[model samples]
Target: MNQPASLPLAESLLAAPLPAGGPAWLDAARREHRAAFAAGGLPDTRIEAWKYTALRGLAQRRFADGDAAAAARGVDVAAFALPGVEGPRLVFVNGVFRADLSALEALPAGVSLQPLSQALRGDAEPLRFALSRPALVGHGREAGDAFAQINAARAADGVVLRVAAHAKSIAPVRLVFVGAAADAELAWHARNVIELGEGAELDLVEQHVSLGEQAQLATLVSDIELGDHARLRHVVVQDAAAGANLIRRSGLRLHARAQATLHVLELGGALVRHDLRAELVGDGAQFHTRGVFMPHGRQHIDTQLAIRHQALDTTSSSHWRGVAGDRARGVFRGAIVVAPGADGSDANLSNKNLLLSPAAEIDTKPELEIYADEVKAAHGATVGQLDERSLFYLRSRGIPLGEARALLTAAFCRAMLDDLPNAVLREHLSGLLIAQLPA
Candidate 1:
């Protein structure tokens, strides 16, 4: 697969010098990634995971590896608001660490929020344990997908959050990824790692947005591990330029008695593909997923998710909803696998999408593979227009047609936002949704 010539620029720019001076082991791993990414530039439909999203459009574009850092000047954090909650916030501008822009004051006991550049010098064991795990991208030694390979080789700064044993954070920890490089050709490779110690509790919010018209490419990876009895709530929102391209992957590991709830919200972006994967490695582990997306115009969004139950007594639940209008395209593919020894595993997955325009498109796939007959697993998917009955009911009340349509769409996403468990945060995100919705 010949990458569009514009990509080599990104390759060269991201391949630049490393902050830690590049360790031998890390460089070797990156070399492997480079080989893998080179082997598979843009996957075709034959690949099961990327069947719907033919990467042809992106492959043809002279995707810019941007160099517009100076243009990122004069950013107003006030103008980029999510509406509801107040808590400790860390801000990143154009993938560069902006510690000065962060509002981090007091951290809970047993919690350390250090940048990767800093962590590399402190501890080796935790870093190895987190990076040694299998990637959700690799299909085999050739590494399943080239995207992960490319990101691993070029990624720059990232946040390393460690929650020590028996610790808890009451307020949500928010990380804001803001992209506004005026140079207009910057490429950002962002990586984040989170480690939860035994019996820890945490709430996290990951936000992404671009402030300018720069042609940018963002590849992000989040690696996370949960210790025994740990609990985590994570929410992610991706909003960027209408021409921005993003490839993001998140991998998770759960130990016994650990639990997690994840919310994915895709409100904006020209092209967005998110790969979310999780594994339950301990008995009594639980996973929950809820997602919402409202795409309009020429926007394109795809979400691929999977949960693996390798231990007994694991439970998983997922529900996702989306609305596509104008020429927008949306997709959701979800899978649940129960291994042989994963007895007593219970899993349920459902995906629902609405095509608001005749030209808009949505493709959804939900799969369940249970090797253990004793395990219970089910999956379902639906793609349809607005409910006729509901629309009629709303119209009969003398409400305007456009307002009624927006109301119905909001109702669908409301359930997911309500799952946040934090009243302040949920309400805050809800307002953001309301602002994004068409009035």
Candidate 2:
């Protein structure tokens, strides 16, 4: 039983591990990422990217893996069962994608689904290419982030989705991160890569829910690449319980004239962090991201969004809203950067938070860095309690106090979810909002 005296747990988690067999260069990269994942941020203070997270003393609770199959009972997946949700849905229990338990009936043409492990060995060229590309570069590197590195090193499992060019599927593809387990209750790591071909269109709903009672440590990383003129509508749902360690990071790249709009909703988890990024790498493209997080109890939720405008005539917008209740802690950081020569670029980033309890904590940051003077960019942050006038109006209308509060809170998040291209997903997510949020 030895502690690193003054060293921070966050830093320790970044250090390197043993190397893997890959191309020499790739192996070197993996080794480097491994070490980085094992290293630390000395003292694990508020100075790093994890400042607003539950980083202190994390070393004392190193994230571990849980029972592979025993966690199905504890998670709240039963709450989301409803009619009209279509297509093949793959459920991953504790980071292991379960194809046998998935439903892929009536899937559309050109739609191929493979587990990450299966894809890596069979027709995995595209996925391998995408995985090899580092989302973090130069000063843009959260590249040094251990969580990302750890995800990279241990990313042998998870989900892989491939859509062909000019194909369209009405069925919503679901990648459910099921967190139910029994003994050996610990952590799970998931690596997912989704590829959309030129002129392809798809709607995807990603559900993250814990299934069992043991403290679940889950880390998920996704890389999405959009081909020319492609369209994708994505909804990310995070609704863990009061005692789960969740870390998720997604990196997206957009090509010419391609458009992708994403809606993110988070309601639970003891400790949660999301590192989401959208890169506009092509001309005449647009990336829109919207998110709402409502955490109750003593939960901690942190969302960091960075959108890079890498080409000309590209537009990006991000709006994040959160309602913190009980003794919850909420953190939001939204950043937009217009790279040099990315002229005619337009970007807007905003974060708004509502604190419902005296003990609730909220931290919000909106950052805009523009290397191009011609780009139109703006950033704003706001934090406050519910509007008293609105509360009074609800009460005057004979609404119960709790009902009115919940209604108002739900309304604040609707703008972020209602715009989802998939009507079914939008409604399902809306229902999940009230279902997951605490009264």
Candidate 3:
């Protein structure tokens, strides 16, 4: 197959100068992954993973490499900031870190937060060790998809968080990636690495948003490692302009007695896809995930999740909800895998979606692969519209027909929105959904 013109930009950008000098091993890894991405090109509908969401729009857009030194005047910092959560905050504009727009709180004794580019230049061994881990059983590659590899090969800037053993953080860390309006289409790639030491705990939030109507493409990759008895609560919110294309991939590994909880809110974008994978490699490891994707108008959103139990007595649970209105489309797939000898493992997965318009569409698939006899695993999916009885009940209470429908729709999504650990964010998302609900 002939490569798209926009695809060539990835190779060109990979050959560009590195943001900072890294170890020899890290440099070699980047070159190899870049080559692999060049060979694979862009994924199309033929690929099982991308069967529903096509990449034609991404291929047709002419995206230039994001300029790291772009002025910060294009973004409004105050308007986008979270309401109540106060702590250290990092801001990135078009994938480049902006110290001028960031604020740092007094760090706890054992936590270190720095930019990935800066950490690489400082010759951090933890980063090298984390990236050196295997993507699959024998592959030591740091990425699972072509877009993830492109991010690793041409990343401009991102966050690197490290917590010392037994350290606990009371304040949450926030990372904001803002897309700037530009005359020419632009592509921005960033990779974030987070490591939590044994017995440590941290709360992290990531948000992606756009400032104007500029056509932009954003690719992000996050790699996380949790040590024994560690806990991490993560939340992701993506709200991009209608002319933007967004792709995000997250890979996580948990150790014995470690726990990871994730909540995602997908509310805005012209086209968006988020892939999340968690591997429990230690006995008693736990993973919990929940997300909500509400797409309206002609927008499209896809959410994919895979949880693997590789150790005895591990546990995994995942649930997601989606709402599609107008001519929009929503897709969800949840897969749970229990490896051989993973005895006593328990896993559950479910996906639910609602369609408010006849023209709107939704596709959902839940899968389970159990290789261990002693393990327990189940998966299911549901797609339907609002219950007529519930709508009628609301109307009988003196609410107008449109208002009744809106209230029921909002209530349906509010169930998942309430899972957010951050109270301020939950309130904000509730208001956003209420304002966007169709009458």
Best model number under TM-score = 3
Candidate 2: TM-score? 0.88
Per-candidate local distance difference test: 0.77, 0.74, 0.80
lDDT score for residue 2 of model 1: 33
Give the per-residue Cα lDDT of candidate 2 at 54: 46
lDDT per residue for candidate 2 within 157-207, as digits (tens), equals: 778888999998787888787776556546557788888999999888888
What does each candidate score in C-alpha RMSD? 2.8, 3.7, 2.6
Best by the lDDT measure: 3
Location of the lowest summed lDDT over 10 successive residues in candidate 3: 134-143
lDDT of 1 by residue, 1-439 (tens): 3343245543454345433455656666666666555544556666778777776666554444434453246778784576554677777777766776677786777778866656666664567655434333344432125566566766656788888899998777888888785544556777788989999998888888887675677788888999999999998887787777788889999999899999888987787888889999999999999998778898889899989999999999999998888889998889899998999999999888888889999988888888886788888999988898999999999988999988988788788877577676677777667776755
Off by over 4 Å in 2: 1-32, 40-43, 46-48, 66-83, 133-144, 436-438
- Model 1's alpha-carbon lDDT is 0.77
Per-residue accuracy of model 3 over 199-218 as CA lDDT, tens digit each:
99998888887888867878
lDDT, residue 53, candidate 2? 69
